[model samples]
Target: MSTIVFAFSIFCGWLIFDVVKHRKLTLESLVSSLVIAVVAGVFWWILDLFF
Candidate 1:
């Protein structure tokens, strides 16, 4: 479940960033998206482990 959530969050982050900046997906958006996604995923996973 956490893995699914992580993947979904990454997709959402990318979509939002792309929409806000370029109105479409771009290579630059992918880099930031991955970064945001990884950080968010790790945080979520840690929280899940605790609770």
Candidate 2:
């Protein structure tokens, strides 16, 4: 539950960062940010499982 929320927050936060940096949103930016967020979420999940 919290992990899911955190993943979404990461996505949103990354998207906002890209938007601010580029001054626009595009498919590339969206996908890149989403990929990064997913990777972070997966890493966090694995860590949670271990510890």
Give the best candidate by lDDT: 2
Prediction-by-prediction clash tally? 0, 0
Instruction: TM-score each candidate.
Output: 0.66, 0.90
lDDT of 1 by residue, 1-51 (tens): 876688677868676968787877777787777777777787788888898
In model 1, pairs of residues that clash are none
Whole-model lDDT, candidate 2?
0.90
Cα lDDT, model 1, residue 1: 89
Candidate 1 weakest ten by summed lDDT: 2-11
lDDT (tens digit, per residue) of candidate 2 on 1-51: 757777899999999999999999999999998998888889888888899
Q: After superposing candidate 1, which stretches have Cα over 4 Å from the reference? A: none
Model 1 accuracy (lDDT, Cα): 0.77
Show the colliding residue pairs in model 2.
Answer: none
Superposed by TM-score, candidate 1 places the C-alpha of residue 31 at a distance from the truth, in angstroms, of 0.9
